[model samples]
Target: MTWKSLKTVLASLVAVALAACSPTPSSGPEATVTVFAAASLTDALTEIAADYERDEGTRVRLSFGASGAVARQVEAGAPADVVILADPIWMDRLAAAGRLDEQRFDLLANSLVVIAPVDAAASQDVFEALSGGGRLAIGTPESVPAGAYARTWLQATGRWKAVQDRLVFAADVRGVRAFVARHEAALGIVYRSDVVGQDAVRIVLEPPPEEQPAIVYPAAGAADGGAEGRALLDYLRTPRAAAIFRLHGFEPVA
Candidate 1:
């Protein structure tokens, strides 16, 4: 080959090599924030995650279950970055175990409601509605946060002892809803968020504050996690998140 032609070919080859080495546009900022949260937070969290990804260019994967179950998962070394729980107890346990940072916030609050099968009569008296062998579904006391709240509510309302025999324990609030939907149970208690858009059952009663424990959802970041987790924790405290929470039937923590 002529020297000039050889030089030109080599220059083109070098240009191609250099072009290959240049960084292409990033596939957006890639991040995996594993959030273990209460199942009741599903709708709100999904919406918040979409908004967060749009602004932060990160992906959020959420796992929803009972708060106590999530705490156990974290305790077992699950690689969760953030935890949003339906109650403070589980969050406190993780913080006490040094799994989560001391910084935590009560993100939102919710109320309890008794749901009945679609054909059930709408009664003015909440407890009396469940009389005459009404099968009640609630979360198991050991692992479900909502079950604990329901029990507390029942006890405070003086119905726990009367209704104990009729109680059918479920693994989680979702399970309780499922049981209620299937007619395996005539009545069940679940978070207000869970009953929205549910056509199989009707919300028969909103538990009076005197009959229920106030439901609070708290969030915290992993103690040893990076900025992504902390950023999410901070973002959850923003007014934007509060608005979203309110939109999903939660009471904003202000």
Candidate 2:
């Protein structure tokens, strides 16, 4: 071959070798943030995750369950990046275990309500509505925040002893809603957010402001979450996310 042609061929071979040795460009999301959240925040967070992924080019992996269950999972070293819980008690446990970053805050608030099957008559009085012999469903008070709040409200209203015999305990707030929706229980106590978009059950009683228990949702980034997890935690506090939470019947914390 001619000298000029040989030189060109050698240069082309060198370029091909370099290209083959270089790392392949990724076509997937820029990063992924795994979140463990309370069951009550399911719909709102799912909507917000879509917006975050589109705007930030990152993926959000969500796992929803009872606040206590997810908190215990994080403590057991489950690979979670962020945690959003319906109660502060569980968040405190995570913080004590050193599983969370310093960036923790109360993210949202909700109210407790008594729900009944859609066919049931509306009742304004919580105690009277639950006076029937039929079962009254609630979350398991020991592990579920919603249940604990329900129990507190019942006790405060002087109805705990009256309703104790008829109580049906569920694994989570969602389970309580399901019990009422499926007619497995005559009535159920759950978060206001849990009934949003649900047609099978309707709110029969909403505790007055004076009687309502303080319901707060706290969020934090896991120590392993690094920058991406912290970013997601911040995004959840934005105005856009607040609007979404409002649509789902939750009050976003300012």
Candidate 3:
């Protein structure tokens, strides 16, 4: 063949070989990671997952709810690749049942704060403010870590018995925020992050760390989710993810 002809033929073969070797364009990983996290982490974790998807080239699906509820679902065979819980107690339950892998870490910590309708005056503390006969909303002590922590704080402050008559229980921390936001309850206890951007409620009191159990968020891969699960767990340990958690009011796990 002439030189130009041979060059053209070689170029065509190279093009064909390139096409044969290249993998098909795809959206993400072959494996999908399903992360079950606490409802309080909704805002922060959503953004973090988006960043993780960008960084790792994987698709991450997040399920957020009360920590206790999430734990129960995972125990019942929910397809969770990773678990990020608001309370270590619920996580421990999963660990004891062997649902979560043994390589767990305390990812973050949070504190409880009392909020009141934004229109309300700021002079009143949580205790005296609730004395105004306003409904007091809290997470359900049975299934909500925030609610459980809030209850412990109140009882420690000697307000549980005194506030019993005015108390209202919500299924989750968001429920408590909703009640206060709508003015259905003048006051409620929720995560600081929950009330951060909300103009409908104002934080009135923050429970001292000594008044309640430290709100530690523990994370681990599910026993069945394998390498993809562990990859997600590892991603969360990165400083970028830790910064996001800190911005959302969580204390970074050292």
lDDT of 3 by residue, 110-131 (tens): 8788899989776745567666
- Candidate 2 lDDT over residue span 184-205, tens digit each: 9988999999999999999888
Clashes of each: 0, 0, 0
- The TM-score of candidate 2 is 0.89
Candidate number with the higher lDDT (1 or 2): 2
- lDDT at 46, model 3: 93
Order of the predicted models by lDDT, top scorer first: 2, 3, 1
Q: Whose lDDT is greatest here?
A: 2
Q: Quote the RMSD, in angstroms, for model 3.
A: 2.8
Q: What ranges in model 2 sit over 4 Å off?
A: 1-24, 27-30, 123-132
TM-score, candidate number 3: 0.88
Worst 10 residues of 1 by lDDT: 121-130
Compute the lDDT of residue 136 as modeled in candidate 3: 92
lDDT (Cα) of model 2: 0.90
**TM-scores vs. true structure, each candidate:** 0.87, 0.89, 0.88
lDDT of 1 by residue, 142-238 (tens): 7888899888888877788989889999988889999988988989999988887789988988866666687888888887667888889899988
Better of 1 and 2 by TM-score: 2
